[model samples]
Target: LDWSFRTTTRAAQKLPENVEEILTEAALREAHLIRKYDIPAALRVNTDQTQTVYQQGTNTTWNKKGDRQVPAVGIDEKRAFTLVPSISASGELLPFQAIYHGATPASCPDRKSPFYTEAEQLGFRLEPSKSDTYWSTMAMMKSLVDDVIAPYFECKKNELGIEDPDNQYSIWKIDCWSVHKSKEFLSWMRTTHPKILVIFVPGNCT
Candidate 1:
């Protein structure tokens, strides 16, 4: 029999213990079967802040005297929101958060609306600063590895009868594309414990 484990950055960090502990428990539970790893939450950033120009119409008109004409026409400048990496608890990578980052016009006629009305209803603005996006992703990833994965293995150490730290068996099934994204966590696993085996599973193969 084969079992698969999936997690995203957010869910990873939310684990009760460190990664090792969770891994150990999972290993013990499925010791009789083959284990496969899958991480659906990994994301890659393709673009940064992009610029967009928008035009607005103002209501400037001449008064009764018509002495002079008022300048009512104007253009509004808007910028494209940066795309950032995000992971869902179910291991889904949501690459795009919002479609637009500028104001909406009352009379605007556009088939596709970039703004996410649902998100706004949830009280979250779509415009996220570039630095915020970068730091948030990194922080969540770090927490998942350090707090969830690590502790999971620790809990299973005794059950696995893994005396030697280096020979311990711990297989990781992550998206083939996410191996690079999780490189830092993998490295940490090897160096910090030295005894645990951190195998990377590409794709969904069990």
Candidate 2:
């Protein structure tokens, strides 16, 4: 077996008390929600976001002697994409969404491309965010709730013979971020998705 040592970033090295509280609350909330709603594991869902970069870094590479830089074939190393995925406690998966930086991809065919519509058919949504280093914003979160979360909640409720609107509930977990703290986002969650409760993980924990 081979092993190597690596250094983690400041965020990875730190584990604050707030993180503990968030974990505790998450567990308690899940238990309470299940008991109160009589929810099956299949109906309880959680979601998180992750980013994928197009570049790979290597410490060792074969090259001509004293070559200034080795030739590498890859897409823009600095470019990245964020993916949001949801899965139920029972392992049921919801359609995933991807966020890109620009209004349209450089590879897009035309100004009136049906790429987005095509993606929708394949159970994925590809969209652009406001910033180049795109993090999920209030608008994006709202769209996520409306187009993905709400629909999934309804589908699960129907499948489990729980149609009493009032009785159907969904538990969605997300990290604590500024975009998620918007008044509009909170109000939308409360009113538009009354049955779907969004839980925030502790700040700096995720």
Candidate 3:
């Protein structure tokens, strides 16, 4: 028997039985909704948040083939922040929000800093989480909608000559995170902005 040493690879997270079915169903449903509403690509938006570390020195290690143990480093400092980016189906990049994790507002960059000024000029927000985790809270989600999503939609509605913002139908795609899927969040969205339809991408489907 001959075996060659190789780098270990990350294992698949999900082994669902019907992955094809799941994805096909999701696509079909989304298409149906878009077609039914005749929503333009400008108003259809998809957004996602990702955590990034200040130092990403090492992500891989030499390992034998078929081994699951892959020791890695560069994350011991545990300093990280969450960045949310959004884009429309028409290829319009929307303003995103950056959430800094800290116990207080002091976590935010100095107002006088160039980074702060650049962020402001670019229409992006750099806000503190006011908590231990960079994960979005109900309040943070609200801010995201009010500051980034709502404004973008409003501009698009105006450009489309839609007089009633309340009647401007659109779709928003987000992951099924706990904060986004909570009853309170859904209720708030329905009550405050019924025109914006929220859809959750099935977790771990890709």
Judging by lDDT against the true structure, name the best candidate. 3
Candidate 3 lands at a TM-score of 0.85
lDDT of 1 at 203: 28
Ranking by lDDT: 3, 2, 1
**What TM-score would each prediction reach against the true structure?**
0.29, 0.77, 0.85
Q: Candidates' lDDT values, in order?
A: 0.39, 0.73, 0.85
Q: Which regions of candidate 3 fall more than 4 Å away from where they truly are?
A: 1-10, 59-75, 163-165
Q: Give the better candidate number (2 or 3) by lDDT.
A: 3
Mark the regions of model 2 whose C-alpha exceeds 4 Å error after superposition. 5-11, 17-22, 59-76, 105-119, 130-132
> What is the per-residue lDDT of model 2 for residues 1-206, given as tens digits with 9 covering 90 to 100?
59677444335557786777777887897788778877778667777888866574444556899889877655236667778998888888888877777665552224366666666675776667765566677767887888888888787777878758566777777776677667778887898878777777666665
lDDT for model 2: 0.73
- Number of residue pairs clashing in candidate 3, backbone atoms closer than 3 angstroms, sequence gap of 3 or more or interchain: 0
Q: How many residue pairs clash in each candidate?
A: 25, 0, 0
Model 1 backbone overlap count: 25
For candidate 1, write residues 46-71 as lDDT tens digits: 11122333553334444667566545
Top candidate on TM-score is: 3
